[model samples]
Target: MGLLVNDLSVHGQFADLGSFAEAIERLMVIRQISLRFGRTLHCHRSLAHARVTATMTMPQAIQALAFEKRRAFMLWLTQHGPFWEDSRKHGPDDWIECNGSIVTDSAVGEAAWCCLNGIKQSLVSLTPSSWEFSPVPVDWVSNTGDKKSTGVVNHWTPAAIEAALQAEPAPLISWSQLDALAIARCTRLTFAADAFAPLNGLPFVSGAAQRLLFVLETLNRFKSCFDVAGQRTPEGHEIYHDFFTGKKEEGGRGALFSDSSDEEKSKFRSEMTFQHPADNTMSLFCSWHGKVQTPQLRVHFSWPIRADEPVYVVYVGPKITKQ
Candidate 1:
């Protein structure tokens, strides 16, 4: 489970990764991936995001990323839509560490935050390379829309994730514990909210049952940039982008539908209608680090998908080398 945000350099709102392909195509790939975030990321994923820098090649940056990431990435690529329901629950303190990220089991709640950060501007590659797919930007984090995460959700366990998979209906909003796990797996944020039930609708508004799905998809996204095993590095490798669809705009949540024909607008409206089920969502700016206020809810804007515009496959990181 994870949160896809706009440009991490400047703070932006949360964005759905539903249109993974179309949005990624427009991302600016540069040398330095920025680690600056609205909240602290898991140490392992933090390590992943920090690997981005202004000077290193994509491959040089994600050198230490593990293969489990690749496995997670592949699983996510094969599926579509929110993955929060499938996120993994863990021991009270299970955590992953990386030079850039420090993530643990207990702290994960609410918004899912997980991604690589701290590089140059969007879509600007530092050194020209021969990689087929260009490096686009994506990050991750965990969050909670309302309640404190208790770790255990509806009796679902880590073992459940590995076995007995059940089909989840379209995401519905509710105050289920899985939502807690989903919030934790996606991104890490400190915010306050009143107790309420999540209404049915929207991408993330649905119950947090998609946690495992988030983990799978995020790992895939994580793997795409890192490509730890050098399976498809530096050239026209399909590994970079296997899970993107132009559906995020189908909903009214994004900025892609601003210019459209009457018929297209109608279709867009028909497709759109889901809003996040929770409300009173606000950004928490903390000052204890002194006093500050954070804009909790925001949308990360990116170039919309255009019928006239052609999409191309591009790699987002340095080429991985065999050890």
Candidate 2:
């Protein structure tokens, strides 16, 4: 009854990139979804295209979508898209169609994929189904059991997912990909603020109190470390760099590491080196951090296209350490 593609019935079928594009186009019209304010004048016409133009690549589009909107994209596809329910609409090979390509052929792992070659569908005169997918991420069970989406689609019901959780409401600390962009109407951005609450207020807090805070701090510190006027000691080193994103020094602050669990520090660094080179506003995870962390959370920042939009993200996660 939850999000999973593990039922064997859906084992071989996957929605590739093109299928993703098609579904996104339809969902936009069906749900009256708009990225019109997303990036360009053309967004009023096609949200998918608008996103690609704004980010300049398909992967970037996935990374750039605000967490909620991305959730919408996945929800509408797996739960409510026309072809997902009625196999009749799929191509002869069982793959969903987009510009005559096989979209379902691609591998299905962490995210949803769509195929589109500049197609459009208008829902104004059509009827939609009562069983619709929600605009939130899902965790599913694949054939191997217990597979989690990277929050790429709606409640996956193909038997791959075994549980259900959304980014909305009061969520416990768990691994969510969109943790960085997640929003709460609050006055404090710090983990200890009312929005984050007890987790931050705990008595023994220190060492990157939370993944979100550490992620943000890492970026800020990274920026400061390389700033034009910033200093490099006589030893040709940046202490802030070594402390925030670098390895643990004998005398360094253990507080800089990600302490998902109260007991130990996580090995997860920040993924900035690969994604953001010279770009002032880009974020991701550290290469090693993924191995030791649990209830995963990662946030990537980008240079805002407009003012007052300095830092934004895609939501998802919890910050707990390994056992």
243: Cα error in model 2, Å:
22
- The TM-scores of all predictions, comma-separated, are 0.19, 0.19
Candidate 1, poorest ten consecutive residues by summed lDDT: 286-295
Over the full model, what C-alpha lDDT does candidate 1 score relative to the true structure?
Answer: 0.24
lDDT of 2 by residue, 281-319 (tens): 774332222110222333323332122223333221233
Runs in model 1 lying further than 4 Å from the true structure: 1-175, 188-212, 215-240, 245-265, 268-323
Report the lDDT tens digits of candidate 1 across residue range 1-323: 22222112211111322222222222211000111211111111221232234444223433333456434433332343123224322222222322234333312211222222111111111111211122221222222111111221111122322221222222333435433543455332211232113212323422132322242233333334424543445422332232221132231121111223355445544322222223335222111010000111111111222223211111111111101
Candidate 1 lDDT for residue 307:
26
